[model samples]
Target: MSSGQQEHEDYPVRDEQNEAELQESEAGDEMKPVKIPPRPKRRPRKRKFVAGLLAAVLPGAGHLYLGLLRKGITFIFLLLLDIMALLYFSSIGMQINVPLLILLALLIPVMYFYNVFDALQAADRILRFPEEHDPEDGEDIKSAASARRRVRITEPGISFGVMLLAGGVLLFLFRQKPPWLQAFIENSAGAAAAVLLIGLGVLMGIREVAKNMMARAGKERRSRRIGRYTASATLAAVGTLLFLDWSYGTDDMMLLLKWWPVIPVLWGIEYLLIYLFSRRSKPGGTVRRARMDLRGLISAIVLAACVFIVTEQEHYLHLWNRVSLNLTAAAVDYGEAEGHQFEKPPLVVPVELNTSKVSIDAINGDILIHRAAVEDIEIKATVWVDQLDGVLAEAIADQSFVEVSEGTTIKITPQSKAYGESGKRQPRINLDISLPEDRRFDLNVRTMNGGITLQNVEAIADISLETGNGELILHRIFGNVKGKTLNGAVRARNVLGDVELGTSGGDMSAWEVSGAMKLSTAVGNIKAYDSGDAVDVSTKNGNVEVAGARAKLHAESLNGRIHVRSADFGGDWEVYSAVGDIELFLPLTGNYTVEGSSGYGDITTDLPGLVIDKKLISGQIGTGEFKLRVDGNSNLNVSKY
Candidate 1:
């Protein structure tokens, strides 16, 4: 230590000797004074204003202009994603969670303003502290505290990205609408909300845990904050209530609305009592004020909004019904639910046709055509309505009448002004049209929210019938038939012409048809018996049974069984089912070849000489002239009867 001090003490003596030698040596040359450059000027305020202007024009452009590449790129991406999500939700016609949509929509403006403010703040920081705000020295600038704050600020973006991605996937699925997803959407609205809330809570809890771990790792003081779990707890409770409603069809939403004051009370208690207690009992024996959490307030508002919406959805529906006339009162079945009935006086309208065709277009009513003894077409109209007072019903019925235009063809239609006022609460006009037996008039009838019944009317021309939400009953019709309904059944018996019928959610049954029968339904059974020429039957979610069908047969069912028994195979037959069995019965003496295949199912045949494997069958019965193709996911049974 003494030697080191002596050396330190001798440093000044050596320096003085060097200085004296230099002064003697510098006598021959001149030494110039050193110069220092001035500091660079601060950036102009005009440039800062331009950056803010760019941010106002577009979210992240100002950040890019200010040379903050990472922030600029992130903000731009977030803006694009937000705009894309908004456009998707607005354009998509599918049923969405409206509350969630509104919340996301609210975030767009919040994020936009945040971007502008952040850009301006960054520019100001750069102007004030140029050395500290070096964009190129991002790694050096990102202290642990700043990095943590950045993570906290961007956490909402991560959550939003997850939500947007999920919503996009759901929207895609809704568009495609596979059976399972459709069912889930139809029955689990509350459950879906619950799942969303649970996911958000889990993300928040995980974030908090990660932040605590990070702080601990950095040896920072850990302070337990009140309302840290309050938001999560509140969301969980509300989500559980909604899920219970969906699971058990309960009125918990209304119950929650009734006792909603409890939530705020408990939230206040946690924020006040717990925070004060935790502040006093510190781990290091030092008191620190815990920062207030506004998340609980936000969560409470969202929960209250959701609760009110669910509880009073019926009133909103009624208001919507009033605003949107396209929404029919038949949607609510006001006729049965309102418990008031009114019937108008019957009106008989005699129609005379110059041509052979008679067309009837009616709305919110049924059209019944019957054989009459009179020579001309006699129409008896009766109007029945509910949910209207006597005065309104009388006025509606007085304006309702059948207009018969006897031009080249006879057109009979029921018109009512009530359709404009009360929407589908307009009078239900039931027309009993009695057609003459001698005059063979072609019948064309179409109606909405009502049925079409043609009973024992043999038309000379083609019989065309359509209804929007009612059945098409064709009994003993002796003409070519074409019938369609969106939400009702199609039943045709003893039809002596080509039959083509389709329905959306009702069964199709054609018995003893003398001509070709083509029938289809989206979610109902199809049964065709004794058809001719050709027979095509298809259904998405129901069974298809054809017996004594002597025609070209094509039958398919997506999730149900298909059974075909042919009196005689007139043409090639093809039958298929995606997830059900297919049973084909042929005549005992037929010259036909059969080929069948199955997936994970047995392929069996009782015919004489047919080779059959577990999943395939290919053989000829007699002459091998005709072809029969059968495919299914389950069993494929073929037998000769």
Candidate 2:
């Protein structure tokens, strides 16, 4: 330890002596002084007011000015696409205007903020990092001088070539004399050209992408090999599928293979074959590999064939046994005579309609008979059915007659031949009647599976229509109507009469109604718009929407919503819902009487005159001529401007 310490101490002393000697030598040598270079002056950056303005008008314009051309172009393209989509959707009446406006509103501010930020940053960078221009070499100077000359000469030649080629192609295809040959050659050439162009473009794009990926990967042989193999396999599979589909008409094969039962059977057979082949093969042998390859090829071929057969069969079947019918005239006859007392017999004793007078009923398969201008008639007819021929024969047969002593009485009896051996029957009759203008008729029509349409028909007294499973459409009717349907919609348009519609399971819609409207449905919505009188709509499980109504509304839904908008209530408005929202829009000036209650909901109102009594509101607005009441057991809200 002592010897090591002595050596360490002696090393410091030797270093001090060497330093002294070096300093003495330097002093003797007489060193020269160093000179410092001056710093370069920084230039002021130009203002980017134009760039910022452009960017404000179009997103990414400032970036384009800053030489971020790729990013700038991408942003501009996306912005343009978004704008076009917004405009297209708006023009198509998609009702996405509010959401689009909000998005655009937000985007504008964001774009402006980004543009200003980027412009300032770009200007700052330009000011901080100015580029130095270098002197041009002889070759560079020559190249620059020749570039413009070359472009000037090449531009005209390129333009002429493109125009000549395009014109020649168009003329060859369109100006050919022979029609069939021209069409064939033009279609073939066009298809070939399109395929070639698309193929070349795809090949070039894929090659460029592959080159970039390979360059980035450097010498990573494993990664490059895997990438190449994966791309090659995918391309091969796609090309194979396309070739088979085109050359062998494999579309039908694919369809057949897609059948529900066929797919499972094929899959099971394939797996079973694979299992058996694997069991028979030796481990790590070429035989197993060969078997696998053969199985895959066979499976693909079989599946393709199956699909083709199914597709072709389905296509053929779809083109069979389709019937089309156009109606020329349709009329309905109710047993009524012209100008006859309700209790008087008809003047014409034997009322008969010839076969030529009636048009054959082919559309809905319904027999129609119309009495032109007869009154006070009695029709007692025996309707017989030929069981052997399945034909209905209706005749008086000397036993049946209809005696109309009073108003027109029309009676419908089921023919005996219409029944099967088991006594089951089917009613296939559709009747549409056009009553005489300014005349009234009481129609009692019944059908099992047919519809009755009455348009421009008015009953001065009362109109009643009943259907088992068909729709009843009443349009422009001016009197009271009572329409009932078992399973079809009841649509009344421009009806001036008091309407009462009932449906077991169909929608009820009334538009432009002048009188009080009442509708009930078991499982469909009730929609009324532009109604002048009070409206009441009830449904077991359907929504109710009333718009532009100037009368009191009482709507109830057992399991749906009630929506009312722009309503002027004469008295009160009530809406009941079991599991849906009640959205009501009322005028700010009208007084409202609201009685709302919910078992598990809130009752809210924005009206100043609305007085809340627990879940009910009974109040007056302005002159307070009418009282309003709305009662329910759900969330209720009232709002006024």
Candidate 3:
């Protein structure tokens, strides 16, 4: 004990010099200043109105000015393509379509406004915000808490299921072109939705593994949050992919459906994995029950309802074939051709030098035409007789059945002779004619109950072929070709000039035509491929499919489907249907504005400013250089090639 300690009695035993030294050290620590860190630097805000004005000069210049590289590049590429298409089509002798011009005019100004709006949004984004801190966590106080309120979705798996369910309903109500699209969605949409649900459940297994590893580092809560987000993202992506596949037509529905059972098996395996991981966690770590994702179950129910409406109900086709099945009226024969047919050596008649036009009128046989090697036009036909009347037999016996009559006109078909029986029955006759290839003359051939084939024929004047109950085939016709059939298909290939073909009860397909063309069918599908210029194709009760048609297109269908692929819209396009889905497959860089509506369905498309109102779907894709007006009662899907 020191003398200073004895004097105070209550203080610790210490020397006087030591106590004074400790007091001086305490005063020095109190005089030190507290240090405060500097706040982070923030980005400068740009004026939205000024940025928008710059965009008016070029489509994406405004966005580029605001440091958005991706959005600016996208806008530039789209606008450039629009200008290119317009100039290219103009050089091909095609007239500038009015609707297309108007669309381009409006799109330029609207884009300017949108660029300004986008820049305004970017300027208002917050760079840094308030954070959180726990008083008990002294070590964590040195770092920013980075606390933020996020939307904690309840059952993210279930939410994804609802998205898929809504998609199914939309697909069923809106019929889109490309029959493959509907069939794939109907067969595979369910499987895809189910797989996604199971995929989310599998994330729970991953979480368990991560939780065990994190528990060793005392970060179990972090692992839990990560797992929750991963699971939600998995489910969300699955639902988004379904819609993306429909928009791009890239789903492997057939391949995926091959092993649908694996979807459930994968979930079972995940459950086992989760169980093992949970056991490996820290002693005091919590383990919650893994709930079964209900998303798949919801998708299943919705898909079932949609399938019933699409297949068993036949909703789209019933618009055309839903007549009462009652057979109250007596059946009436459609009148079959009944007559004894007579045959003779094929007649070969040389046309007079002055002949310039040829006409053939046959009652019930096919008409075929080829270029004859001879110097003059020749005719070959089979003579038939049901009753063998005197006038008919006399006309056939003599080669005068076909002779040059009026100036330059050759009449091969004999005048119609009523065979005294019911006017319904006519003698079956087949006519095969050949003409010089170098000579171009007017030609007309008509048949009541047979097909017509014109091969490699060049006509200076109008060439017409008509059939009542058989197909009409035209190959390499150089002039204006008009072909029609009442109960058979119509096909034209390598037609050089304008062509028009129509069929009442069969399909109509045409290809390689160098001029404007029109083909329609009443009870069957219509397909036209590799043809340019203006085209008009329609079908009343069957699908209408067209590919590689690069011009103005007018396609129509009632109670059927309409699909257009790889069509270059150099002019206006009008596509309409009653119950069938309408699909227009254009290149990803296609520039057009589609303005139309659907009565009972919605129009689905992916574009910058797409607006879907009640029965109305309108949007500007790319630069909107062209106009595509599609109207349908069921569904309309626009896809990128």
Output the number of the lDDT-best candidate. Answer: 1
Where does model 1 exceed 4 Å of error? Answer: 1-353, 419-424
Ranking of models by TM-score: 1, 3, 2
TM-score of 2: 0.37
Estimate TM-scores for all models. Answer: 0.48, 0.37, 0.44
> Highest TM-score: which candidate?
1
Model 1 worst lDDT window (10 residues): 318-327
lDDT of each: 0.72, 0.51, 0.61
Number of clashing pairs, model 2? 35
Superior candidate under lDDT, 1 versus 2 = 1
Worst 10 residues of 2 by lDDT: 320-329
Tens digit of per-residue lDDT, candidate 1, span 1-641: 69989998777555788988888778645665556988875543436898899999988888888877667766776666666666554444233334445555776888789889998887876665554454544445447555554443323246446655765675566455466654565567567877777676666667666765675454565555556566766666677777777788666766765776776687788778756665564455666456657765576557647655643453233232222222333443323223233454544445555567788877677788988688677777877655567677667667877887875467887876554343645567778888788777777787766889998888785887766678999888889987777788889999889898887789899899988888988889999888866898988899999998776788999999999997587688899999998888888787778888999888887877788876789888778778889889998888886
Task: Tell me the TM-score of model 3.
Answer: 0.44
- Candidate 2 residue lDDT tens string, 94-198: 112233343544555655576667765655554443332111211232354354443322222354455446545544533333455434432353234334434
Please provide, for model 3 over 1-641, each residue's C-alpha lDDT reduced to its tens digit, 9 standing for 90 to 100: 99876878876578999999999999998998878898864445555676667676676777676655446655665455455444433332122232333344555565567756665554333112212222122223233223221111011235445644654554444333344544555457655654655565466456556765675566534322223333344344444544455456544333333544554555556557655655564556655334454554344433433322322221122221111111111221122233334444555555666667677765566778888676666666554554455665455334323333444666666433334344333445566778887777778776556889989988876787765668889888889987666678788889888888877688888899888888877789888888768888877799998888788888998889999987466767899999888887876666788798888876787644568787787888678888889899988787776
Evaluate residue 26 in candidate 3 and report its C-alpha lDDT on the 0 to 100 scale: 91
lDDT of 1 at 428: 73
| Model 3 lDDT on a 0 to 1 scale | 0.61
